[model samples]
Target: MHLLIITREWPGYVLGGISHHICNLYNEVVDKGHEITVITGTCPQSSHELTGKKPPANEVHTVQFGYRKGYYVLFPIALRNYLQSFDFDPFDACITHTGVPFELPLPTVSKRHDCYEATKEYIRNGLSFLETIGDRLMGPFRTIVDRRSIAAADCLIYNSAVCRAGWESAYNITTPSIVSHNGIDTSVFYPDSGYNKEDYILFVGGSERKGLSHVISFARQTKEDVIIVGPDEVNSPHVDALGRLSSDELRQVYTNAAVTIHPAGWEAFGNVILESVACGTPVVATKNCGAVEVLPSSACVVTSEIERGVMKAKNLNSEDCIKAASKQTWDKPAQDMIDIVRSITNPEC
Candidate 1:
């Protein structure tokens, strides 16, 4: 089967959880004897100096669409024009991995990494009303576009039940959907990485929506040794800032730390939670994070009370955490996606 994948985040081109998800999914789908044609935007990693390792060789054919101007909302219009201008081969199915909605002539699946409704809510809480005035003004336009584009797709794939709930809650409608969680590269993020355990809290992401403020409060309250990578500088005595670490360095921290904290305000699926667990470190996450849904009861303490959760997670069984994380490789979700595509294109098995 020939599949069409449309996304902005491509391997080596963009850095994020979505990029990692799409890159691994593309590889997994290709390995199962399917040809993939990708349409992506230009977001180069070189601009940010993510130069530790070369991106894995992507075997699929890819085409990039250069938008004349900005606005992520313009992707649909640009993609429509790009397809109309070129003569492309018919694909059995098209999977769109984008925040905004997209439409395709072929059988299409909307793969949602995050939902905007809850995202906006979290953003508003983090910022002032004036800061969100622009979003408020553009809300109707975005909602209209989403209604037209996403409602027309044959199927929708959500990264987590939490994400799906948020999407549906905002729209007050339902669609043909499947909850296929993100996968982890167990080979790199595993227990026994030759790192001695240390008594400290670790917070990975540095975004406002990721609850950076919550982590800061936790650090100040507990006065525990906290190694983080978010803020440009650190003034606190308890917190040590490691600007940005390579994949190897990140894994080393995950293994050595007593616990990893993910106090996300509205995460679709917190990959860092699983990554920390895969490396034999327990996690402390809020219910707003989707990754907490699949974690074993023994692996993490799900609570916004970071101080208590972080302290309790330190005693969580490492073997239980690793056992749960080992099952989340990319191939399983890719195969499930293939099944959905085949079902859409060919009604009879």
Candidate 2:
């Protein structure tokens, strides 16, 4: 099957887990012998520099969409024009990884990695006064777009049950959806046998909703060093901000850290937790997030008990971490996607 994937974040332009998710799925689908084309947004980083790895799309067409707040409103319009101008045979299926395209000739499947409603809830609960006001002004428009996009799709795919529930609750509609968890690349993120682990704690995410403030507070109370890797630069006496690291470098950090922390109030799916476990590192994650779905109860703890969680994680066996991570890989989810697309094209099959 020839597949066309539309996403704002691709390899080299990775904004978060969604980028990695798309890239990994692209690689797996291609390896299975399907021709793939990607319509993605522009990013400043070159393909090679994105992750010290080349992008996997067989054909990539970039659009000039910026990553600012209101740019998504124009994405479907720009994408519609681009597709109209392109001359090609019909694609078997078009998968919108983030949101639905304004128009598409092929069977369209919308994949929801994050729900706008959940994001809005987070903003309302966590943002400053100014930010909250800004969200209020844009809320209606965003809601309209989000509803139309989801309703437009022939089928829906969600990264987690939390994401699906949030969308359904927000829109007051229950569309049939596939709940497929994101996977990790074991080859790149697996345990490093030679390097000795460190005593420092690690946190990877740029947003305040990712529980950065909570992690900082925990770091201040503990004597252990805290290393942060993300787009945001955090300034705290107890925290050392590395900004962002390549996949290889991040793998090393995960492998060496005593424990990784994910304090996010909510996540569609927490790739960081899986990545840390895949690297033979235990994680201390908050309850009520998507990580709870994949992580064992032993590894998950309430946010208030993060310090104690860290102590428990320290004694977790490295092998146990790897074993838990091994259950999730790109193969299953990629194949599941392929089957969904095929079923859409040939319902009798």
Best by lDDT: 2
Clashes of each: 0, 0
Model 1, span 1-349: residue lDDT tens: 8887777556555645566777677678877888777776553231233323323332333334454122346666556667776444567888878643555668888888887788877766655677578678878877876687677788888889999998888885566989999888887788664578998899998776888878877788886888897566666666788978767778888999999999988999988999999998999999989998888879989998998887788778889999989888888889989999999989888
RMSD of 1: 3.0
- The CA lDDT at 16 in model 1 is 57
Off by over 4 Å in 1: 43-71, 99-102, 124-131, 234-237
User: lDDT of candidate 1 vs native?
Assistant: 0.77
Question: How many angstroms is residue 305 displaced in model 1 relative to the true structure, after the best TM-score fit?
Answer: 1.3
Q: Relative to the true structure, how large is the alpha-carbon lDDT of every model?
A: 0.77, 0.78
Q: Residues 1-349, candidate 2, lDDT per residue (tens digit)?
A: 8888888767766654566677788788888999888887654432433454535666788876644455456566667767778754757888887665354677888888887677666657667898789878887877777877877788888888887887887886554578888888899898776878999999999776678788989988998899999855677878999978877899999999999989887777888888998998888887646755876755444454778988888888888888888888889888889988998889999
Off by over 4 Å in 2: 12-16, 43-58, 101-103, 121-134, 231-233, 298-304
Question: Could you tell me how far off, in angstroms, the CA of residue 233 lies in candidate 1 after the best superposition?
Answer: 2.1
- Give the backbone clash total of model 1: 0
Clashes of 2: 0
